[model samples]
Target: MALRPNPTLRQRRLGSELRRMREQAGLGGSELARRLGIGPAQMTQMEQARIGVSPERLRMVASACGCSNEPLIDALARMTSERGKGWWEEYRGVLTVDFLEVAELEAHAERITFCTTAYIPGLLQTPAYASAVFARLFPPLPPREIETRTEFRIRRQELIRSGGTPLHTFIHEAALRMQFGGPSVLLDQLRALLDDSERPGISVRIVPFAVDTFPGAGENLTFANGPVAELDTVEVDVSQGALFLESPTDLANHRAIFSRLDATALAEKESRDFIRSIMKEVESSNA
Candidate 1:
């Protein structure tokens, strides 16, 4: 079968790994190109994820770079070799590139931690809440578009629930209380959270509004762990743009914030009950 022209998330990730490895090895673009028998421009494009890498070429570059990390290399090889359409491919041209990028990241992440302020995190939202969210954001999206985005959000959550490992999420109280999608949607979303909380490998905690201060600065943050490859990435989402961090210092800072957030959050059981309380309030209002 002919390989697809557009790169999948896995392929793009491999490209990122190659570039990171080369940079860590202290080789400049020109120097790396000379060693790999490739032009510098090609090397740049490969590193930027503008092109898919070949397994043989990847190995050759790895060998030349003196990278003996077999597991990492093997993972990259497999990622590069993956040749199929991903579900998210259907959303191309319909959704923003940023949304697509996040979906790709979620697909590869074995573990995820996130903090939200304005709305429920996509992975944990119920379809109704998700719909309401989209309705509010676009206000004019056709029914079909609303449904598409909602489905996309739910599918992202499945990455954790249907997999060998479950995703972990920590939500701030402010986000949980704002009640997007109104009472009914919020009630359903809370119920879904409670249901998922009982599953193995999934941990949901609520950070209280009384935490005083946190390291997340002013926006939502996500930390993704690639368990097999032992890679950790921290993503900070701001109004301006999303920031990706891989440095130890950056990771440590995010870790500290997470730890504090986790510590101060309502206990697991209490958090569920807290959500139950909200559900009751919503139901009472509806009645």
Candidate 2:
């Protein structure tokens, strides 16, 4: 097969995990290639995600690496077996890769947790608010680009609306009051948030300004729980774009940060009340 020019994050992660398995078994690429009856370069391509790995090949590699963790090996095999194209692929060339990868990550996530300080989480954003947020980009995007991004974002929210995956989001009071599109837009957004908070599989909590301490240094992050803990991933929103984190250390740290934010935020019922209060304020201000 021809080598992939730009492998998706999931593809790269599979390669990384394969490499990790080899390293843990203290085997060099050449040695593994010899054992697997393939050329060293072929092994390198597989490990680099430039080429695909069949389930049989993946199991063979796991056996060679002395990896007895059946659950992990099964998960890897499933990853290798996935052949369906995701909905995000439709926007592949039109939007940035980060957007597509983020959607992919959420689609595969068994559970998702989001923490934000300044802006509403994408999975919970209204179309008007998302369009407004995109409109204010530093290097302003063209009108067409803004519309595309807003549409993509609204599409992403389908994962939440499906209620198949559990979602827990922590938003700071500051984000609730940002008025991205305008007071009217933010009001609609907040009301939508309130409605979503009551959903069976969704949890929305607010971190009030009255809180004595806040964590995560005010960063916006999404932690996606994988089928297995080792497969978990985190996406941090930065000025450049979405940064995906998967190393054991990065996963642990972000998980801890989410825990801290969870503890600091108000309970679900209280958060709903808080949002209602904010809606009233927005209405009064507009009046």
Candidate 3:
């Protein structure tokens, strides 16, 4: 099979896990290749996600490498079986690869937890709010490009609306007051957020400014929980782009951060009331 020049994040993650399994078993690449009756180059390709691995082949690798993590193995096998292009594929070339990766992560996530300090979470933003955000890009994107990006972001919310995956989001008080598209837009966004919070599988919490201490140093983060804890991934939004974290250490640290945020955030009923208060403040200011 032809090696893939550009593998998706999921593919690369699978490859990385295979490599991890081998390393944990203290086996060298060549040695494993010999045991599997495959060439060293083939092993390299499989580990780099350039070539696909069948479920049967994956199990063979696990057996050969002495990996006893049954749940992880089963999840990896499921990933190997997944085929066909996702909805994000349509925007493959139009948007940056990071955008597609984010969607894919959310699509496969068993649960999602995210925190935003200055801006509303993308999955919860209203169309106008999203457009205003894109319009303020540093170099400034073309009007058409802004529309494209906004459309892409809105489409990402489909997973949330579908109720297929549960989402718990933490939004700092600053985000609710930013008024991205001015008071009118912010009001609509907050109202939409409240409505979304009432959804069956979605939970929204607000971290008030009154909190004595904040975690994550105000960084925007999205944690996508996988089928197995080891497969979980964290996406940190930075000015350069989204950075994905998957190492055991990174995952553990982020999980801790989220735990702290959860502790500091308001309860669901309180958060709803707080949003209502913010909406009133916006309405009063606009009037």
Top TM-score: which candidate number?
Answer: 3
lDDT of each: 0.76, 0.92, 0.94
Per-residue C-alpha lDDT of model 3 across residues 126-185, encoded as one tens digit per residue: 999999999888798999999999999999999999999999999999999997778888
Ranked by TM-score, the better of candidates 1 and 2 is 2
Candidate 2 residue spans exceeding 4 A from truth: none
How many residue pairs clash in each candidate at the backbone level? 0, 0, 0
Q: Write down the lDDT that model 3 would get.
A: 0.94
TM-score of 2: 0.97
Backbone clashes, candidate 1: 0
**Which 10-residue span in candidate 3 carries the lowest summed lDDT?**
209-218
Per-residue lDDT of model 2, residues 179-225, tens digit only: 89899889889988988899999999999999998887568988999
